[model samples]
Target: MGNCGSSASSEIHDIDYGHERVVYYEEADEVQKVGSVYSQPGSKGLNQDAGILYQGYGEENGAFCGVFDGHGKNGHIVSKLVRNRLPSLLLNQRNTLAKAITGERADGDLFQSKQVIKWKEACTSSFKLVDKEIKLLDNLDCSCSGTTAVAVVKQGDGLLIANLGDSRAVLGATTEDGIMAVQLTTDFKPELPCKLLLLYIQFLFVA
Candidate 1:
């Protein structure tokens, strides 16, 4: 982990996990940006990928990060589109929810009690919307192409994650035996969880 100061209102952080670059965030006044990208590509072809999102996510203390693995013929296109759009979509959903729930409530109250749940809902709706947008694109052919996504949003000491497809997230912790890796999220795949498979089936039907 390393940190560098950009300005009074903003700073950048990088967290390294082995050779893979795991997560990064920038904080500037009311703007926060989160992202992660693998430093190296797969054994096959060139690295066609993306990382992170737009600004104005949350307060200065919060951040959002995501990873995308593109596969198949038009996989690169799909991944890039989602990476570029998901952040705005998520913030939009979160803000809309905030308005609905903040009618007669204090902002700090909502931040203290319901922030994580709010972020979870926002992430879910954003992912679903982005998926639809991908399919609706007139130029892209995603018949056999798709991308795996895993995202995390951090507010103060709280964390919220949303994932789809087969991407995974892990945490490195200090143990008695030195550093240990703990799996934080599952690799959503066809031969894996029954729930994911069912969700995949539902998605297929919906598509």
Candidate 2:
């Protein structure tokens, strides 16, 4: 894990598992910028948290950011796998959806609606594909190990956010009083009603 600054001329920045890099937009050096990410290892001696920040992602002024939290044994591997592959998979899905709608009338509300639907579909498809890929890994044991993923994609003025498991995404908005934090996604935890119901069903079958 290493840290490097972004150049003023470039809008794109990338950070991987082992190699860490940060990009700041303003002239003054500040940790908090348009493209910045931070991750630290736990007391277990291995960093189970992984993240990515890509500026100029799908188009100019576009960005993609994700944070994954690993749990159980061999979870770090799973988190890294998702972090590395999910972005490309999502982009491909988005592109395919865009191509399919090329001839359609994309203006005003219709265009916005279609874009939202496509992005939601793309995120869903990409996540499923990543899960399948992880399951197919012969060298990895994921029976009791998994990772939570939370990602946000920005294209022009539109923002598409997706979450799986307990990871979260929050948006900081400038309010009249001060900066307000707006949660973008819900954390899917076992304490939720749906999860509790599923657990009860499983326990009944077991008993």
Candidate 3:
């Protein structure tokens, strides 16, 4: 649960979460930012959940948001760790890609092409790196426990979404009659037909 806005004060706002720092940028030339977040635990006790909502991601006018749901004994810890780390990892990867592409001469047709490709690459790299780091944590035992992540990034009018596990997202739009809901992702659990087929084949081989 959080809210953020970009101000023209030239000061960087930060809040510490354990050893990690969550940052909010406020600069005179920065883009306008406004958003709020809220969360409530379900009926189950001992909640193990985490989430993020950032109004200015990498560039001005960009946004990033995600939800993490943890399962198993140490699920709470894993969820918090991811919530703290993933955003920074994503921004860093994007910035690195931007720097590498700046030196290359762009063909008019390839200008937007590279930017799109790089953003996708950044998302991929950040996810992999974070997963590896999680596995390497000495104190947390994730052998039978893990977390599901679903994220969305907004760059001006365009959006990029990524998901792992069963979490879902939807877009709401105003229609002639009223507001309508549009689903943006499919459920990625093993119950899906393709995954069920793969699991069945694996069981046969093991038998």
Q: TM-score winner among the candidates?
A: 2
Q: Supply the TM-score for candidate 2.
A: 0.78
Report the C-alpha lDDT of model 2 over 1-207, residue by residue, as the tens digit: 445444443433444445332222222232233555676554666667778776657863666788888888988788878888888899999889977766666466676577667877788788889999999999999999988888888777667777777788878888799998977776677878674212110000000
TM-score of 1: 0.72
Clashes of each: 1, 0, 0
lDDT of 3: 0.67
What TM-score does prediction 3 earn? 0.76
Off by over 4 Å in 1: 1-38, 53-56, 103-111, 197-207
Instruction: Go through the candidates in order and give each one's C-alpha lDDT.
Output: 0.61, 0.69, 0.67
The order of the candidates by TM-score, greatest first, is: 2, 3, 1
Tens-place lDDT per residue, model 3, 1-207, is 333333344454444333222344433555577654445566676667676666656674677777778889988778778877888898899889888777665574475567767777887889889989999989879888878777888775567777777767677778898988977766667767564212010000000
Best by lDDT: 2
Of 1 and 3, the candidate ahead on lDDT is 3
lDDT of 3 at 35: 54
| Candidate 2 lDDT | 0.69
lDDT score, candidate 3, position 20: 27
Lowest lDDT sum, 10 consecutive residues, model 2, at: 198-207
Q: After superposing candidate 3, which stretches have Cα over 4 Å from the reference?
A: 1-31, 103-109, 193-207
